[model samples]
Target: MNSEKLLAILKLQATKNVGDIIAKKLIAATGDVEQVFKESKNTLHKINGIGTHVTDSLFANENLKRAEEELHYIQQKNIGFSYFLEDDYPQNLKHCIDAPILFFKEGNIDLSNQKIISVVGTRNITSYGRDFCNQLIEDLKDYNPIIVSGFAYGVDICAHKAAIKNNLQTTGVLAHGFETIYPKTHKKYISEVHKNGGFITEFWHDEQPMRENFLKRNRIVAGLSKATIIIESAKKGGSLVTADIANSYNRDVFALSGRANDIYSTGCNNLIKNNQAHLLSSADDIVKMLNWDLSKTSPPKQKELFVSLTDIEQKVYDYLQQNGKQLLDVIALNCDIPVYKLSSILIQMELKGVVKPLPGKLFEI
Candidate 1:
């Protein structure tokens, strides 16, 4: 984007009481972000939701000054950024109602048609949570998913480490700016994270890691991914808020259940009990829920079609073989397997050439 248009977006972000939603409305009404600034106060006020208070903040001298300072820092440091309207903006985040209009990024980041998922949980991660997070990413490695997390202590860092170990791209969404790293100890992981993936933050260069900033950052974590998984959380925590944001975006959410007495499991259990999230058991849950590619090792072979099958796969194959083509739901019901597991089983059967998938989710032998 041109410098002129970039400055306008920063100024809008720096403006008080003018959030992403209102900024978007203003942009839509004005036809462009640059045009929003060129319009007179009276003209801008005529637009819906752009009242005196917002207009006053929109043109405030101080806001412009801050924007200019941030722009200068960005230019000096050669920072990379993505405006919401740009082609490089995250596809999943673009659909969010309150996603940042502009955000700075650093490191080798790529979002091109990638399978992404955010794994979040309590900072006080338990042995159980850590093991589960590790195994989950290990299993998902075959699918080559990009793991996203806060890069904080406990579950966040655990998720990042697991992803790195699996050689999958990982993104750490920061609460503060690039100028500083929170939890000073994390400074060591920065280089490794950048090499593997990168860091992203909506804050300007010098912004501090305030309490509220973390809350605001959760939206990005939730928005950037196809689904958000909570490994563990207290009854009240930022991860749960992320799950809520993901749900609001009409994205699927999964929560790992734990013993009732475990402190960190409270939030995840509550989410599942309330039907806010799917009950996540193993990696299969996500594999099935997201309908990710099940043939992880190789493409289906063209050999003569004879292959062995598990009892469940046999039931599905026999049903299809006898019944001709059938809808996925019908097969699931007749085979007495839930649609979630049935989907994966069918994919395996297809890879073995025991069944063929047809258009509109139908299957046949």
Candidate 2:
């Protein structure tokens, strides 16, 4: 984007009471970001959601000053950014109504790979959660997914590390600006994260990682991916907030199931029990749900010859082979297996390379 347009976006972003949704409306009404500032106060006020206070903020001289300062910093540091309307912006995030009009990024981040999933959980991650997270990324390496997370403690950093170890690109969504890294200890991982993928944030260059920024950051993490996975979370935590946001976008959400009494498991278990998320037992569940395996030009039917299946698995395979793709509920009813039991059985068959999952809960041999 040109300097004038960038400054206009920054000014709009700096305006108090003018959020992404409102900024977008102003831009849409005026036909351009720069035009929003050029338009008269009366014209802006005529737009819905633009009241006197909003128009006043939009014209605030202090906002333009701040925008100029930020623009200078961006130019000096050679920072990268993606405007909402630009082709470079993340496609998944573009669909979110409240996504930032512009977001800053750093490192060798690539959005071309569509096999993206965000994994988040509690800051106090358990050993079970950690191991599951590691193995999950390892299993998914073949698919070369872009693993995204908040770059915070526990499950977030764990997922990033695992993705790097598996030689996969992992993007960290930051709650603060590029000027400072939150949780000083994570500074060591920043270089490695940059090498593997990079960091992205909607906050300005010097913005602090305030408490409220995390809530805003969660949406970007959830928005950047095709699905959101909660490895572990308490009954109330930020990861659940991401899950909620992902759900609001009508994206798939998978929650790792743990023992009911486990503290961190409470949130994920609740999500699954409430039908708000799928019961994720393994990476196969994600592979199936996202239909990542369908991209194969010639799926390896040879693996089936060497694979072994339980009687129930064999039954499901036979049914799917005869019926083509079938919904989870339909397969459960026709095969005399309860839906709950069939879900896990299908996942196992998926791991054994006997069946493939399609979108909308459909499955095929």
Measured on C-alpha atoms, candidate 1 has an lDDT of: 0.89
**lDDT of model 2, residue 8:** 90
Q: Which ten residues in a row have the lowest lDDT in candidate 2?
A: 297-306
TM-score: which candidate is best? 2
Worst 10 residues of 1 by lDDT: 296-305
Clashes of 2: 0
What is the per-residue lDDT of model 1 for residues 1-365, given as tens digits with 9 covering 90 to 100? 78998898999999998999999999999999989889999999898778899998888889889999999999999899998998999999999989999899999999765589999999988878988998899878778889999999888988887877667799999999999998797776787789889999999988899999999999999999999999999999999999999999999999999999999999999999999999999999999999998575445334344577898888888888899999999988888889989987876675454675555799988
Cα lDDT of all candidates, in order? 0.89, 0.90
Global lDDT for candidate 2?
0.90
Best by lDDT: 2
In model 1, which runs have C-alpha deviations exceeding 4 angstroms?
A: 295-365
